[model samples]
Target: MQTYEIWDSEYRFMTIVWDNAPIGSGALCTLCLQQLGWKKSTVYNAIRKMCEKGLIQNENATVRVLVPREQVQREESDAFLRRTFSGSLPGFLNAFLSGRTLSEKEAEELKKLIDAHRKEG
Candidate 1:
């Protein structure tokens, strides 16, 4: 899978697109102004950059996401794990859970997920 690096501002912009896609460019600009406090040029510039990165498409004055949200999230998570924990899931989990308590339901769900993905070996 290919992953594009997205900055915080771009990610926030993408979130709006992902939520209300196939939106008119003018509408998108309005949304950016309302939600992000961004100006028209800033919205257009980010859109152009994202288009160049193949993360979104602008056609007929309409904007839409070329990349799905899940893919970007997976890529971000994988990169974080690799960079922070040397790709060790256990290490990452340990650090993430430190001083944090999971609810019973949350713990059960995680346990089920781990069981389902456990190695056959």
Candidate 2:
């Protein structure tokens, strides 16, 4: 399996691209500058590096996603589960919600999500 690891800066950059893709490189520079305080050169460098990494595409000076945001989120969460909780969802949840009280709605929503993703034998 290919790793979809991204640094914090790259992840922030990718979130922007995911939100507003097929955006002109110049427009991207503007948005990055406004939102991330990144200059044009910084934006261009990110575009170049991410393009080389097959995470995004730059065609006709317009940028688009090559990897969907959900895929990256899933990979990132899976990696976290592996690294921090030894891939144990229950363990992770136990630690995360140790002192927190879940509302009925929240508990029901989590149950629904678990049911939806559960594998059928």
Candidate 3:
């Protein structure tokens, strides 16, 4: 598995590419300018950096994602849990739910998911 550490700006840039992939590089620049307020050079620089990180590909002036967004999200979530909660899912959930109430339906759904994933032994 290839783990990528994407910063906030880089993730934003990748989100754009993921949403509209196989887009022309010039069009990407225009989208970045309109959405992110970035210049053409900034868009090109970000593309080059992402390509170097194996997160995206720019081929024949068309851009596409090399790594799917879900993989990066999963990796980022795992890393956050490990760093902030010492890899304890309960600890992370407790902190996340502090002062926040889940809807009854949402709670029930979460319970069902936990039950489905529970250990048998």
For model 3, the stretches where C-alpha displacement exceeds 4 angstroms are: 73-121
Q: TM-score-based ranking, best first?
A: 1, 3, 2
**What is the C-alpha RMSD, rounded to one decimal, of candidate 2?**
11.0
Model 1: per-residue Cα lDDT at residue 73: 41
Clashing residue pairs in candidate 2 are: none
Q: Write the per-residue lDDT of candidate 2 for residues 46-85, one digit (tens) a residue.
A: 9998898899999999999988876664234454334467
Candidate 3, clashing residue pairs? Answer: none
Write one digit per residue (lDDT tens) for candidate 1, span 39-80: 999999999998998889999999988999876642354443
Q: What's the C-alpha lDDT at position 35 in model 1?
A: 99
TM-score of each: 0.59, 0.58, 0.59
Candidate 2: which stretches are off by over 4 Å?
Answer: 1-3, 73-121
lDDT of 3 by residue, 1-121 (tens): 7567887788898899999998999999999999999999999999999999888989999998889987774235454335467778887687777834678899999998888888542
- By TM-score, the better pick of 1 and 2 is 1
Error of 3 at 109 (Å): 44
TM-score of candidate 3 on Cα atoms, chains taken together: 0.59
